[model samples]
Target: MTISSRVRLICLTGALALSVTSLPLSWPNPALALSDIKDITPAPPEQDPPATPAPAPAPGDDEDLSDEAFPVIPDPDPLIKPSNTDESDATTPQEPAPEVIYDLEKAPEPVRRMRQLIMDAAASGDIQALKPLLDVGANQTQVPLQTSDQDPIAALKGLSGDDEGQEILAILLDILSTGFVQLDKGTPDEAYVWPYFAGKSLALLSPRERVELLRIVTAGDVAEMQEQGNYNFFRVGISPDGRWKFFAVGD
Candidate 1:
Protein backbone atom coordinates (compact mmCIF):
# COMPACT_ATOMS: atom_id res chain seq x y z
CA MET A 1 0.00 0.00 0.00
CA THR A 2 0.94 3.47 -0.73
CA ILE A 3 1.78 5.92 2.26
CA SER A 4 -0.69 8.68 1.44
CA SER A 5 -3.74 6.29 1.23
CA ARG A 6 -2.94 4.58 4.47
CA VAL A 7 -2.56 7.96 6.36
CA ARG A 8 -6.04 9.21 5.27
CA LEU A 9 -7.74 5.95 6.40
CA ILE A 10 -6.21 6.21 9.92
CA CYS A 11 -7.24 9.88 10.40
CA LEU A 12 -10.81 9.05 9.49
CA THR A 13 -10.92 6.30 12.15
CA GLY A 14 -9.55 8.65 14.88
CA ALA A 15 -12.11 11.36 14.10
CA LEU A 16 -15.00 8.89 14.46
CA ALA A 17 -13.76 7.79 17.90
CA LEU A 18 -13.45 11.41 19.19
CA SER A 19 -16.97 12.38 18.16
CA VAL A 20 -18.51 9.31 19.86
CA THR A 21 -16.80 10.02 23.20
CA SER A 22 -17.86 13.78 23.41
CA LEU A 23 -21.50 13.42 22.42
CA PRO A 24 -22.84 11.77 25.67
CA LEU A 25 -21.26 14.50 28.01
CA SER A 26 -22.98 17.59 26.40
CA TRP A 27 -25.65 19.79 28.65
CA PRO A 28 -29.50 19.74 27.84
CA ASN A 29 -31.90 22.87 27.98
CA PRO A 30 -34.00 23.62 31.23
CA ALA A 31 -37.28 24.07 29.28
CA LEU A 32 -36.84 20.57 27.92
CA ALA A 33 -36.63 19.08 31.64
CA LEU A 34 -40.12 20.51 32.88
CA SER A 35 -42.09 17.69 31.38
CA ASP A 36 -39.65 15.17 32.95
CA ILE A 37 -40.23 16.67 36.52
CA LYS A 38 -44.04 16.37 36.07
CA ASP A 39 -43.60 12.70 35.40
CA ILE A 40 -41.57 12.18 38.78
CA THR A 41 -43.27 10.88 42.22
CA PRO A 42 -42.38 13.87 44.69
CA ALA A 43 -40.05 11.80 46.97
CA PRO A 44 -42.83 10.04 49.13
CA PRO A 45 -43.84 13.29 51.17
CA GLU A 46 -40.55 13.63 53.27
CA GLN A 47 -41.22 10.39 55.37
CA ASP A 48 -42.71 12.19 58.74
CA PRO A 49 -46.15 13.89 58.87
CA PRO A 50 -46.60 17.51 60.29
CA ALA A 51 -47.28 17.98 64.12
CA THR A 52 -50.97 18.63 65.18
CA PRO A 53 -51.86 22.11 66.69
CA ALA A 54 -53.28 22.41 70.36
CA PRO A 55 -57.03 23.29 70.76
CA ALA A 56 -57.99 26.67 72.38
CA PRO A 57 -59.89 26.85 75.82
CA ALA A 58 -63.50 28.27 76.12
CA PRO A 59 -63.80 31.85 77.51
CA GLY A 60 -65.73 33.17 80.60
CA ASP A 61 -66.16 29.85 82.57
CA ASP A 62 -65.93 30.16 86.45
CA GLU A 63 -64.00 27.68 88.69
CA ASP A 64 -65.62 25.99 91.79
CA LEU A 65 -64.00 26.96 95.18
CA SER A 66 -66.40 25.24 97.70
CA ASP A 67 -66.11 24.04 101.40
CA GLU A 68 -65.85 20.40 100.19
CA ALA A 69 -62.45 21.43 98.79
CA PHE A 70 -61.37 22.74 102.29
CA PRO A 71 -62.40 21.70 105.93
CA VAL A 72 -64.14 23.14 109.07
CA ILE A 73 -61.96 24.92 111.72
CA PRO A 74 -62.81 24.73 115.50
CA ASP A 75 -62.12 27.07 118.50
CA PRO A 76 -59.11 26.13 120.68
CA ASP A 77 -61.01 27.06 123.96
CA PRO A 78 -64.81 26.48 124.30
CA LEU A 79 -65.33 26.44 128.11
CA ILE A 80 -64.44 30.11 128.71
CA LYS A 81 -67.76 31.43 127.34
CA PRO A 82 -69.88 28.98 129.42
CA SER A 83 -67.93 29.83 132.62
CA ASN A 84 -68.69 33.54 132.23
CA THR A 85 -72.40 32.78 131.73
CA ASP A 86 -72.46 30.61 134.88
CA GLU A 87 -70.84 33.38 136.99
CA SER A 88 -73.51 35.84 135.87
CA ASP A 89 -76.31 33.38 136.73
CA ALA A 90 -74.92 32.70 140.23
CA THR A 91 -75.17 36.35 141.43
CA THR A 92 -78.30 37.24 143.53
CA PRO A 93 -79.49 40.36 145.40
CA GLN A 94 -80.22 40.28 149.18
CA GLU A 95 -83.41 41.56 150.93
CA PRO A 96 -83.59 44.25 153.64
CA ALA A 97 -84.70 43.47 157.28
CA PRO A 98 -87.73 44.75 159.27
CA GLU A 99 -87.90 46.95 162.41
CA VAL A 100 -88.63 45.53 165.91
CA ILE A 101 -91.21 46.65 168.60
CA TYR A 102 -91.10 46.08 172.39
CA ASP A 103 -94.12 45.42 174.75
CA LEU A 104 -93.49 45.88 178.52
CA GLU A 105 -96.73 44.11 179.39
CA LYS A 106 -95.10 40.89 178.23
CA ALA A 107 -92.27 41.21 180.74
CA PRO A 108 -90.82 37.90 181.96
CA GLU A 109 -92.35 36.04 184.97
CA PRO A 110 -89.15 36.19 187.06
CA VAL A 111 -88.95 39.99 186.87
CA ARG A 112 -92.62 40.28 187.93
CA ARG A 113 -92.12 38.07 191.01
CA MET A 114 -89.05 40.06 192.06
CA ARG A 115 -91.03 43.33 191.92
CA GLN A 116 -93.87 41.73 193.94
CA LEU A 117 -91.51 40.75 196.76
CA ILE A 118 -90.19 44.31 197.06
CA MET A 119 -93.77 45.68 197.13
CA ASP A 120 -94.75 43.22 199.89
CA ALA A 121 -91.78 44.13 202.06
CA ALA A 122 -92.42 47.88 201.68
CA ALA A 123 -96.17 47.46 202.43
CA SER A 124 -96.08 45.11 205.46
CA GLY A 125 -92.75 45.60 207.26
CA ASP A 126 -93.77 42.16 208.52
CA ILE A 127 -90.45 40.68 209.60
CA GLN A 128 -91.60 37.24 210.86
CA ALA A 129 -93.94 36.49 207.94
CA LEU A 130 -91.33 37.71 205.42
CA LYS A 131 -88.67 35.45 206.95
CA PRO A 132 -90.78 32.31 206.40
CA LEU A 133 -91.87 33.50 202.94
CA LEU A 134 -88.30 34.34 201.93
CA ASP A 135 -87.16 30.90 203.20
CA VAL A 136 -89.58 29.37 200.73
CA GLY A 137 -88.90 31.67 197.74
CA ALA A 138 -88.36 35.41 197.15
CA ASN A 139 -86.39 37.87 195.07
CA GLN A 140 -85.60 41.53 195.73
CA THR A 141 -85.75 43.70 192.63
CA GLN A 142 -83.22 46.57 192.61
CA VAL A 143 -84.88 50.01 192.47
CA PRO A 144 -83.22 52.55 190.23
CA LEU A 145 -82.50 56.08 191.46
CA GLN A 146 -84.49 57.83 188.70
CA THR A 147 -88.20 58.32 188.08
CA SER A 148 -90.01 56.41 185.31
CA ASP A 149 -90.94 59.77 183.73
CA GLN A 150 -87.23 60.72 183.67
CA ASP A 151 -86.22 57.64 181.72
CA PRO A 152 -84.79 56.01 184.84
CA ILE A 153 -81.68 54.42 183.36
CA ALA A 154 -80.90 57.43 181.15
CA ALA A 155 -81.44 60.00 183.95
CA LEU A 156 -79.05 58.14 186.28
CA LYS A 157 -76.49 57.68 183.52
CA GLY A 158 -72.96 58.71 184.68
CA LEU A 159 -72.91 61.48 182.07
CA SER A 160 -75.48 63.40 184.20
CA GLY A 161 -73.00 63.59 187.15
CA ASP A 162 -75.90 63.49 189.71
CA ASP A 163 -74.96 61.99 193.09
CA GLU A 164 -76.36 58.43 193.13
CA GLY A 165 -77.21 58.77 196.90
CA GLN A 166 -79.41 61.88 196.48
CA GLU A 167 -81.17 60.37 193.48
CA ILE A 168 -81.76 57.17 195.49
CA LEU A 169 -83.27 59.21 198.37
CA ALA A 170 -85.72 60.87 196.01
CA ILE A 171 -86.62 57.46 194.60
CA LEU A 172 -87.39 56.16 198.17
CA LEU A 173 -89.72 59.09 198.81
CA ASP A 174 -91.53 58.61 195.50
CA ILE A 175 -91.93 54.89 196.16
CA LEU A 176 -93.26 55.51 199.65
CA SER A 177 -95.88 58.05 198.44
CA THR A 178 -97.28 55.73 195.75
CA GLY A 179 -95.98 52.19 196.02
CA PHE A 180 -97.26 50.16 199.03
CA VAL A 181 -99.21 50.09 202.35
CA GLN A 182 -100.25 47.60 205.02
CA LEU A 183 -103.91 46.95 205.91
CA ASP A 184 -105.28 47.17 209.48
CA LYS A 185 -106.55 44.00 211.16
CA GLY A 186 -110.07 44.11 212.65
CA THR A 187 -112.78 41.98 214.36
CA PRO A 188 -113.95 38.82 212.62
CA ASP A 189 -116.17 39.50 209.61
CA GLU A 190 -115.27 43.23 209.82
CA ALA A 191 -114.50 44.91 206.52
CA TYR A 192 -110.80 45.82 206.08
CA VAL A 193 -109.83 49.50 206.63
CA TRP A 194 -107.82 51.03 203.79
CA PRO A 195 -105.43 52.81 206.24
CA TYR A 196 -102.91 53.55 203.49
CA PHE A 197 -100.45 52.97 206.34
CA ALA A 198 -99.21 49.82 208.11
CA GLY A 199 -95.70 50.86 209.30
CA LYS A 200 -93.94 53.05 206.77
CA SER A 201 -92.01 55.20 209.32
CA LEU A 202 -88.77 53.38 208.43
CA ALA A 203 -89.65 53.05 204.73
CA LEU A 204 -87.79 56.01 203.14
CA LEU A 205 -84.46 56.22 204.96
CA SER A 206 -80.72 56.05 204.32
CA PRO A 207 -78.61 53.13 205.55
CA ARG A 208 -77.62 55.06 208.77
CA GLU A 209 -81.25 55.97 209.44
CA ARG A 210 -82.28 52.36 208.90
CA VAL A 211 -79.64 51.11 211.39
CA GLU A 212 -80.80 53.63 214.01
CA LEU A 213 -84.43 52.65 213.37
CA LEU A 214 -83.55 48.98 213.73
CA ARG A 215 -82.01 49.64 217.19
CA ILE A 216 -85.02 51.63 218.21
CA VAL A 217 -87.37 48.86 217.09
CA THR A 218 -85.30 46.24 218.96
CA ALA A 219 -85.41 48.40 222.15
CA GLY A 220 -89.18 48.80 221.74
CA ASP A 221 -89.03 52.60 221.56
CA VAL A 222 -92.66 53.63 221.90
CA ALA A 223 -92.34 56.68 219.63
CA GLU A 224 -90.83 54.54 216.84
CA MET A 225 -92.87 51.41 217.53
CA GLN A 226 -96.29 53.01 218.06
CA GLU A 227 -97.45 52.93 214.40
CA GLN A 228 -96.73 49.22 213.95
CA GLY A 229 -96.49 46.42 216.60
CA ASN A 230 -93.00 45.39 217.86
CA TYR A 231 -93.55 41.84 216.65
CA ASN A 232 -91.05 42.89 213.97
CA PHE A 233 -92.98 41.32 211.01
CA PHE A 234 -90.47 42.73 208.54
CA ARG A 235 -89.27 41.08 205.37
CA VAL A 236 -86.18 38.86 205.31
CA GLY A 237 -86.23 38.96 201.55
CA ILE A 238 -83.92 36.63 199.59
CA SER A 239 -83.29 36.03 195.89
CA PRO A 240 -85.39 33.40 194.14
CA ASP A 241 -82.17 31.41 193.79
CA GLY A 242 -81.29 32.13 197.46
CA ARG A 243 -78.38 34.28 196.34
CA TRP A 244 -79.05 37.28 198.65
CA LYS A 245 -80.75 38.38 201.89
CA PHE A 246 -82.68 41.56 202.83
CA PHE A 247 -84.17 42.79 206.14
CA ALA A 248 -86.85 45.43 206.60
CA VAL A 249 -87.50 46.23 210.30
CA GLY A 250 -90.95 47.20 211.69
CA ASP A 251 -91.69 49.79 214.38
Candidate 2:
Protein backbone atom coordinates (compact mmCIF):
# COMPACT_ATOMS: atom_id res chain seq x y z
CA MET A 1 0.00 0.00 0.00
CA THR A 2 1.05 3.63 -0.46
CA ILE A 3 2.93 5.13 2.50
CA SER A 4 0.21 7.79 3.05
CA SER A 5 -2.49 5.08 3.16
CA ARG A 6 -0.41 3.07 5.60
CA VAL A 7 0.03 6.15 7.82
CA ARG A 8 -3.74 6.87 7.72
CA LEU A 9 -4.48 3.30 8.67
CA ILE A 10 -2.12 3.62 11.64
CA CYS A 11 -3.83 6.89 12.71
CA LEU A 12 -7.24 5.25 12.47
CA THR A 13 -5.99 2.35 14.58
CA GLY A 14 -4.71 4.73 17.27
CA ALA A 15 -8.06 6.62 17.26
CA LEU A 16 -10.11 3.38 17.56
CA ALA A 17 -7.93 2.17 20.46
CA LEU A 18 -8.40 5.45 22.36
CA SER A 19 -12.17 5.38 21.74
CA VAL A 20 -12.41 1.71 22.88
CA THR A 21 -10.51 2.39 26.07
CA SER A 22 -12.98 5.19 26.94
CA LEU A 23 -16.06 3.07 25.96
CA PRO A 24 -18.05 1.25 28.69
CA LEU A 25 -18.40 -2.60 28.96
CA SER A 26 -21.64 -2.29 26.93
CA TRP A 27 -19.51 -2.64 23.80
CA PRO A 28 -20.28 -6.07 22.19
CA ASN A 29 -17.18 -6.61 19.96
CA PRO A 30 -14.05 -5.20 21.70
CA ALA A 31 -12.09 -8.48 21.34
CA LEU A 32 -13.06 -8.65 17.64
CA ALA A 33 -11.77 -5.12 17.06
CA LEU A 34 -8.27 -6.00 18.31
CA SER A 35 -8.34 -9.42 16.59
CA ASP A 36 -8.94 -7.72 13.22
CA ILE A 37 -5.89 -5.50 13.49
CA LYS A 38 -3.55 -5.86 10.36
CA ASP A 39 -0.57 -4.34 8.57
CA ILE A 40 1.14 -2.83 11.63
CA THR A 41 4.38 -1.13 10.68
CA PRO A 42 7.61 -1.97 12.52
CA ALA A 43 8.76 0.62 15.08
CA PRO A 44 11.26 3.17 13.73
CA PRO A 45 14.83 2.35 14.61
CA GLU A 46 16.11 3.99 17.82
CA GLN A 47 17.46 7.46 17.12
CA ASP A 48 21.16 8.17 17.74
CA PRO A 49 21.92 9.77 21.11
CA PRO A 50 21.48 13.54 20.88
CA ALA A 51 24.87 15.19 20.36
CA THR A 52 25.96 16.76 23.68
CA PRO A 53 27.43 20.28 23.66
CA ALA A 54 30.84 20.95 25.11
CA PRO A 55 30.90 21.98 28.80
CA ALA A 56 30.76 25.73 29.32
CA PRO A 57 34.06 27.38 30.31
CA ALA A 58 34.41 28.91 33.81
CA PRO A 59 33.92 32.69 33.91
CA GLY A 60 37.58 33.35 34.74
CA ASP A 61 39.13 30.68 32.45
CA ASP A 62 41.45 32.06 29.73
CA GLU A 63 40.84 29.27 27.14
CA ASP A 64 37.62 28.90 25.18
CA LEU A 65 36.30 25.42 24.24
CA SER A 66 34.66 24.24 20.98
CA ASP A 67 31.66 21.89 20.41
CA GLU A 68 33.72 19.94 17.86
CA ALA A 69 36.75 17.98 19.18
CA PHE A 70 38.46 17.17 15.89
CA PRO A 71 41.98 18.61 16.22
CA VAL A 72 42.71 21.41 13.76
CA ILE A 73 46.03 20.09 12.49
CA PRO A 74 48.04 22.53 10.33
CA ASP A 75 48.70 21.50 6.73
CA PRO A 76 52.23 20.18 6.19
CA ASP A 77 54.78 22.24 4.21
CA PRO A 78 54.49 21.74 0.44
CA LEU A 79 56.33 18.56 -0.59
CA ILE A 80 59.87 19.48 -1.64
CA LYS A 81 62.02 17.84 -4.33
CA PRO A 82 65.56 17.12 -3.20
CA SER A 83 68.38 18.81 -5.11
CA ASN A 84 69.95 15.90 -7.04
CA THR A 85 71.55 17.85 -9.87
CA ASP A 86 75.00 16.58 -8.98
CA GLU A 87 73.73 13.04 -8.59
CA SER A 88 71.89 13.23 -11.91
CA ASP A 89 75.07 14.53 -13.56
CA ALA A 90 76.84 11.51 -12.12
CA THR A 91 75.59 9.17 -14.82
CA THR A 92 76.70 5.56 -14.90
CA PRO A 93 79.69 5.27 -17.26
CA GLN A 94 79.86 2.86 -20.17
CA GLU A 95 81.83 -0.37 -19.62
CA PRO A 96 85.39 0.00 -20.94
CA ALA A 97 86.63 -1.79 -24.04
CA PRO A 98 88.80 -4.78 -23.09
CA GLU A 99 92.57 -4.02 -22.93
CA VAL A 100 95.65 -5.88 -24.07
CA ILE A 101 97.37 -7.62 -21.16
CA TYR A 102 101.18 -7.69 -21.27
CA ASP A 103 103.76 -9.41 -19.08
CA LEU A 104 107.16 -7.74 -19.44
CA GLU A 105 108.92 -10.30 -17.22
CA LYS A 106 108.03 -13.24 -19.42
CA ALA A 107 108.08 -11.32 -22.71
CA PRO A 108 110.65 -12.47 -25.30
CA GLU A 109 113.93 -10.52 -25.47
CA PRO A 110 113.03 -8.97 -28.86
CA VAL A 111 109.54 -7.94 -27.66
CA ARG A 112 110.94 -6.41 -24.46
CA ARG A 113 113.60 -4.60 -26.46
CA MET A 114 110.93 -3.33 -28.88
CA ARG A 115 108.86 -2.02 -25.96
CA GLN A 116 111.93 -0.29 -24.57
CA LEU A 117 112.71 1.35 -27.92
CA ILE A 118 109.21 2.86 -28.15
CA MET A 119 109.37 4.10 -24.56
CA ASP A 120 112.78 5.68 -25.20
CA ALA A 121 111.56 7.39 -28.38
CA ALA A 122 108.55 8.82 -26.58
CA ALA A 123 110.65 10.02 -23.62
CA SER A 124 113.22 11.67 -25.91
CA GLY A 125 110.67 13.19 -28.32
CA ASP A 126 112.01 11.01 -31.17
CA ILE A 127 109.24 9.48 -33.30
CA GLN A 128 111.83 8.15 -35.78
CA ALA A 129 112.70 5.15 -33.57
CA LEU A 130 109.02 4.42 -32.80
CA LYS A 131 107.99 4.39 -36.49
CA PRO A 132 109.11 0.84 -37.37
CA LEU A 133 108.01 -0.40 -33.96
CA LEU A 134 104.53 0.82 -34.82
CA ASP A 135 104.20 -1.73 -37.61
CA VAL A 136 105.41 -4.70 -35.54
CA GLY A 137 101.93 -6.09 -34.80
CA ALA A 138 100.11 -4.06 -37.44
CA ASN A 139 99.08 -4.98 -40.99
CA GLN A 140 101.00 -3.36 -43.88
CA THR A 141 97.84 -2.34 -45.75
CA GLN A 142 96.77 -0.12 -42.84
CA VAL A 143 99.97 1.96 -43.04
CA PRO A 144 99.59 5.40 -44.58
CA LEU A 145 101.46 6.13 -47.78
CA GLN A 146 104.37 8.61 -47.58
CA THR A 147 104.91 10.25 -50.97
CA SER A 148 108.35 11.75 -50.38
CA ASP A 149 109.80 9.90 -47.39
CA GLN A 150 109.57 6.11 -46.97
CA ASP A 151 111.28 6.44 -43.55
CA PRO A 152 108.29 6.09 -41.16
CA ILE A 153 110.08 7.54 -38.12
CA ALA A 154 111.30 10.70 -39.86
CA ALA A 155 107.88 11.19 -41.45
CA LEU A 156 106.16 10.85 -38.04
CA LYS A 157 108.69 13.13 -36.32
CA GLY A 158 108.27 15.81 -39.01
CA LEU A 159 104.50 15.69 -38.58
CA SER A 160 103.92 15.90 -34.76
CA GLY A 161 104.33 18.54 -32.04
CA ASP A 162 106.86 17.88 -29.25
CA ASP A 163 104.41 17.06 -26.42
CA GLU A 164 101.89 15.26 -28.60
CA GLY A 165 104.62 13.16 -30.21
CA GLN A 166 105.61 11.82 -26.80
CA GLU A 167 102.04 11.07 -25.82
CA ILE A 168 101.45 9.19 -29.05
CA LEU A 169 104.60 7.14 -28.60
CA ALA A 170 103.72 6.31 -25.02
CA ILE A 171 100.35 4.97 -26.13
CA LEU A 172 101.95 2.87 -28.86
CA LEU A 173 104.45 1.40 -26.42
CA ASP A 174 101.55 0.52 -24.15
CA ILE A 175 99.81 -1.24 -27.04
CA LEU A 176 102.95 -3.09 -28.19
CA SER A 177 103.46 -4.36 -24.66
CA THR A 178 99.84 -5.45 -24.32
CA GLY A 179 99.40 -9.20 -23.75
CA PHE A 180 95.82 -9.64 -25.03
CA VAL A 181 92.71 -7.71 -26.01
CA GLN A 182 89.00 -8.40 -25.49
CA LEU A 183 86.33 -7.60 -28.09
CA ASP A 184 83.07 -7.65 -26.20
CA LYS A 185 81.10 -7.02 -29.40
CA GLY A 186 82.90 -9.61 -31.56
CA THR A 187 83.03 -13.38 -31.74
CA PRO A 188 86.03 -15.52 -30.77
CA ASP A 189 87.24 -15.90 -34.37
CA GLU A 190 86.55 -12.33 -35.53
CA ALA A 191 86.32 -8.94 -33.80
CA TYR A 192 86.93 -5.38 -34.92
CA VAL A 193 89.53 -3.33 -33.05
CA TRP A 194 89.88 0.41 -33.29
CA PRO A 195 93.59 1.08 -32.81
CA TYR A 196 92.66 4.74 -32.63
CA PHE A 197 89.86 6.28 -30.68
CA ALA A 198 86.51 5.69 -32.37
CA GLY A 199 85.97 9.41 -31.83
CA LYS A 200 88.99 10.14 -34.08
CA SER A 201 89.12 8.40 -37.43
CA LEU A 202 92.29 8.00 -39.58
CA ALA A 203 91.06 10.51 -42.17
CA LEU A 204 90.40 13.07 -39.41
CA LEU A 205 93.42 12.73 -37.06
CA SER A 206 94.93 16.01 -35.84
CA PRO A 207 98.65 16.77 -35.99
CA ARG A 208 98.73 15.79 -32.30
CA GLU A 209 97.72 12.23 -33.24
CA ARG A 210 101.23 11.75 -34.65
CA VAL A 211 101.67 8.43 -36.50
CA GLU A 212 98.74 6.66 -34.81
CA LEU A 213 96.28 4.80 -37.09
CA LEU A 214 92.68 3.57 -36.82
CA ARG A 215 90.45 0.43 -36.42
CA ILE A 216 92.55 -2.61 -37.32
CA VAL A 217 93.89 -4.42 -34.20
CA THR A 218 92.98 -5.62 -30.71
CA ALA A 219 95.15 -6.35 -27.65
CA GLY A 220 94.30 -6.27 -23.94
CA ASP A 221 96.71 -5.16 -21.23
CA VAL A 222 97.99 -6.56 -17.93
CA ALA A 223 97.94 -4.47 -14.75
CA GLU A 224 98.54 -5.41 -11.13
CA MET A 225 96.03 -2.70 -10.09
CA GLN A 226 92.82 -1.44 -11.72
CA GLU A 227 93.88 2.17 -12.29
CA GLN A 228 97.45 1.49 -13.43
CA GLY A 229 96.69 1.72 -17.19
CA ASN A 230 93.16 3.11 -17.19
CA TYR A 231 92.35 5.86 -19.68
CA ASN A 232 89.13 7.82 -20.17
CA PHE A 233 89.80 8.35 -23.87
CA PHE A 234 92.23 6.30 -25.99
CA ARG A 235 92.49 4.13 -29.09
CA VAL A 236 94.02 0.63 -28.80
CA GLY A 237 92.99 -1.89 -31.42
CA ILE A 238 93.80 -5.56 -31.92
CA SER A 239 92.54 -8.53 -33.91
CA PRO A 240 90.24 -11.03 -32.25
CA ASP A 241 93.14 -13.45 -32.50
CA GLY A 242 95.29 -11.07 -30.37
CA ARG A 243 97.11 -9.14 -33.05
CA TRP A 244 97.85 -5.42 -32.67
CA LYS A 245 96.11 -3.34 -35.29
CA PHE A 246 96.30 0.41 -34.59
CA PHE A 247 96.92 2.49 -31.45
CA ALA A 248 96.27 6.17 -30.74
CA VAL A 249 95.72 8.51 -27.79
CA GLY A 250 92.92 11.04 -27.53
CA ASP A 251 92.66 14.50 -25.96
What is the C-alpha lDDT profile of model 2 across 24-80, one tens digit per residue? Answer: 977585465756888589989999999999888889886754647656677887789
TM-score of each: 0.17, 0.28
Show the lowest summed lDDT stretch of 10 residues, model 2.
Answer: 217-226
User: When superposed on Cα atoms, how far off is each prediction in RMSD?
Assistant: 28.1, 22.9
Each candidate: what lDDT?
Answer: 0.38, 0.48
Best candidate, lDDT: 2
The per-candidate count of clashes, in order, stands at: 5, 25
Clashing residue pairs, candidate 1? 125-233, 126-233, 126-234, 127-233, 127-234
